[model samples]
Target: MLTIGKLGQAAGVKVPTIRYYEQIGLLPEAERSAGNQRLYSRKALDRLTFVRHARELGFTLDAIRDLLSLSDHPDQPCAAADAIAKAQLAEIEKRLARLASLKVELKRMVAQCAGGSIADCRVIEVLGNHSLCAAEHGPRESEGDS
Candidate 1:
């Protein structure tokens, strides 16, 4: 049995995250002691560990719920789980591509700056006018209010 803080420390998760998982039904409500302190069994620890591992791998809460549901039914086909993994991989690839592009553009921008004053700074000059920028900037740069 442990207090919430002790449980969080043991599980390598924050206390609020544990509460969030509980609120979202990923974790079952723990049995309370005489002073209303939450207690856990080894089973709860295992479940929380599973949930924490999934989250550390970047699975969204909704996807974690789906994975948990799939895990509960051992006889189910694993095609759905495969699809989720594929989606996450695709997202990671997309982010990597975007980051690579950003790196290239930043290098190009930095090359233009020669430690001049702000009025003559090529970096600021190119940024203030996208038409003057050599790099084909993406959609994330414009329409800030949206």
Candidate 2:
């Protein structure tokens, strides 16, 4: 059995993140030691590793939960998993396109600059007036609040 700290170290996840996973049901509740400290099994280690990898791949918590459910039932078809991955890929592609548009808009703003004062700055003017933009380069619905 591994203590919570050891499990976190071996999994390359922080102690609080491990606890958060447990709280959110991504990780199963750990066994308790005689002293009331959290103890983990090898299965917990493996599950934490899987969660870490899924997070690294940008899978949302909800998607990870679904994937975990799918993993628990290996006999089931992988279509759901495949669909989740496909949706993630589509989201990435959409973000890439938006980034490309933002890049073009920035380039246009920069190229039009005459190195004048702020009052005559094309970049500032374009920023101040969204209508002057050549394309709709706005933040994604999930972004901007942060």
Expressed as tens digits, the lDDT of each residue in 36-129 for candidate 1 is 8788777777778888988877787888888888888989899999998789788667666777776887888898888989999878887788
Q: Mind giving the per-residue lDDT tens digits that candidate 2 earns over 1-146?
A: 99989999998999999999989888888889889999999988998888898888888999999999999999999999999999999977877787788889999999999998999999999999989999885655764421
Question: What TM-score would every model get versus the actual structure?
Answer: 0.83, 0.86
Error of 1 at 15 (Å): 0.8
Q: What are the Cα lDDT values of the candidates?
A: 0.79, 0.89
Of the candidates shown, which would achieve the greatest lDDT relative to the real structure?
2
Clashing pairs in 1: none
Residue 129 alpha-carbon offset, candidate 1, angstroms: 1.9
lDDT score for candidate 2 against the true structure? 0.89
Deviating ranges (above 4 Å) for candidate 2: 138-146
CA lDDT, candidate 2, residue 58: 81
How does candidate 2 fare on TM-score? Answer: 0.86
